[model samples]
Target chain A: MKDKKPMKSVFKAGAITSEFIGNSIYKHQTKTSIGAHNIFLGQVRADDIKGKTVSAIEYTAYEDMANQKFHEVRESAFEKFDLTCMHIYHSLGTVKAGEICLFVFVSSPRRKVVFEALEFIVEAIKADVPVFGKEIFEDESHQWKLNS
Target chain B: MLITIKYFGQIAEVTQKEEEQLEVSKGSVSGLLNTLNTKYSDLKNKDFQIAQNQELVDLDTELTGAEIALLPPFAGG
Candidate 1:
């Protein structure tokens, strides 16, 4: 259903509310045989590198680019897999370290495709999207995380 | 035409400013970077990247009035 609204990432300081992603997940499912649902949630870890404790993650993206990439990812998934529905939502700003950064949900008529679709969407988001984040540390020192 | 470009993160640090305009024949992204490298040699040795309208682009990608941004390696988890 194209009219079903896609989820918007909760880009804010502190924690992400379930509603941001839950709504989209709810819309994606219908009472069909669709046997499996797979979800991946990415949480920011308080990684301590070189004595710096990552306090928060500030997510940024070129809106135009990211939206385009999102549409492309959706299309590729439809072409590459046998799926019922899929949803991807990534935070855009200030997700505190240890909070959620991204959420991916995939549902399919069969179990096998959900796994493949989950992996595919996650990898695409990491590699192709124009999202950038700054890992802010306790001491306020920051570092960039490469897609690699 | 003079096209204004924006820089973020390490790119801003090196350029010492947020935005500036470059005069060119709406050339390729690589050509612009080359001109910038000629003026600021530090870029030649750094890990900076180019984006046109926020999409990561190859060096040879052509630019035509697109909003350009220079970004260093990302730090998002």
Candidate 2:
């Protein structure tokens, strides 16, 4: 977190479902000015580590701090890109492999802007957010995940 | 000063609790960490960052008795 002023945004519980993502896109249909939309979905990978295969990831965060960081990322994205709208959601609790855990949606008047804005926002979230993940193996053993 | 400290991810695992309050002398963040290392011996070996209030602070920064957090390497996507 970069700022002491905490911004409040509730964390989403469980995996992000396709239905939820669909509904989000459905709602955006009313914003006709947005000519292009780009999305980034972060899915849990069943990675193998030391002979153990990951079955799920349990995410946790310093919620108040994470909210504050998210606020900064959002504010900076708006300032740097001409985005018509932006949305981000990250999962708390256990998300199994193949399930979506992070969703970033960005829209703009032009295709190029949406593409660039989406990449910028996604990279910022990875580097700045305080969210942590515990990669749970099939046998119940787990290890903390690190951003590469 | 009474300081509140929070632990997350692997740091919480080492500390064995998520949050705690301690009565400590006002000092640099590293000084407070020295006290914590004595209490939680594994904390010194863990990879983490210190946050004073909610902002990330280095070890040399003075503690302000605000809410502090020990954060491990981030995995947020």
Candidate 3:
């Protein structure tokens, strides 16, 4: 079935907790039409830049445009794949290293559709969405993060 | 024409503010950039793309929309 949900704000103020993620999974049990569920979680990495280490990432976005892009991505995914439901959540404020910053859940009637849809959505977000991240170093310095 | 400009990420740091409205002559995207680059001198050194009405537009595109955004490289996941 085609999903015709309205545009939603995918941003959360802080890091996404495992409890929230687990609860999300728990909430989907009643949707027995979904035979497979695929998830993609983007965690903040403690990357070493030269001599310093990244401690956290503070995210910001062009909110209106980002939400619009997310809507377009979701719509296209539904058109391309047979999915039961899909959800996307991204961190807005500071997220510590090793914490989840993005959670994308896609459920479908088959395993292949979920896998393909999840990848398409994630890649589209990385390339098209106008979300910025400031990587704060352990020493208190910061640098803008660029998706590579 | 008066246009509202939004600066994001590194572009905002150069502009020192996130949003501003400017009175500009009827022109193209590059014309608006020329004005901004003059207003915020450091803007030329930074890398960014331009969006008109939330959609990316080339510099040669005519200035048709009132809202323009200077977007630095996206880092979303």
Candidate 4:
């Protein structure tokens, strides 16, 4: 059976706060059927480039396409794994170093499914989404970040 | 035909604008790229992919008067 369409917005302005993350986890407590939950958080790193350190990442995206791609990833994951639920949130605008930029949470009745599904969703997001990031240096200069 | 082209991220920076409309004769995606390359010389040096109507298309793909977007390298997590 096809999964229901994902109606939630995956993009959030600025950073994904720990409070928000905590609340999300708290909300999932009522789903007693879900025995395992796996979470992946992507944090911005302060990488030194030519003696300049990255202070923040300014993100931008073709919003319509990104959302569509996110939905496709979710659907594919559900079809491949027996997941109970999954959530993905990505930050737009400026996210400071050490702040969360991406969060992927997956739940399943079994631990193995959650583990495999989380990695699949994360990898798909990195490779397929049209979101872009500009690395702002401490010197005020900036460079585009390429997925490696 | 009048085609609307959207630019994102560093590609937008190089173009110095978010989007533009151009009147062009019937042509392929490569033909559109040639026109844009002439209009914005800086874009020639950048690496990017082209999306037509929100889906990635080959340069040889014919222009169907769809919304075109120039997307830079994805760094999304």
- Kindly report which residue stretches of model 2 are placed more than 4 angstroms away from their true locations once superposed: A1-10
Residues A1-148 of candidate 2: C-alpha lDDT, one tens digit per residue:
1112335573799999999999999998888888898999999999989899999999999898898899889888888888888888999999999999999988887899888888888898899989999999999989999998
Question: Residues A1-148, candidate 1, lDDT per residue (tens digit)?
Answer: 2222453442344455678668766765564656888998888888889877889877776556667777788878878988777766677768887778888788877899999999998888887776777788988878766666
Which portions of model 4 miss their true places by more than 4 Å?
A1-5
Please identify which of the two predictions, 1 or 4, would achieve the higher lDDT against the true structure.
4
Off by over 4 Å in 1: A1-15, A19-33, B16-20, B38-41, B53-56, B74-77
C-alpha RMSD values across all candidates: 3.2, 3.5, 1.0, 1.4
Give the local distance difference test score of model 4.
0.93
Interface RMSD of 2: 0.5
Residue A67 C-alpha lDDT in model 4: 94
* Candidate 4 chain A, poorest ten consecutive residues by summed lDDT: A1-10
lDDT of each: 0.74, 0.90, 0.93, 0.93
lDDT computed for candidate 3:
0.93
Q: Show the colliding residue pairs in model 3.
A: none
Per-model TM-score versus the true fold = 0.81, 0.96, 0.98, 0.97
- Each candidate: chain B TM-score: 0.88, 0.95, 0.96, 0.96
| Accuracy of chain B in candidate 4 (TM-score) | 0.96
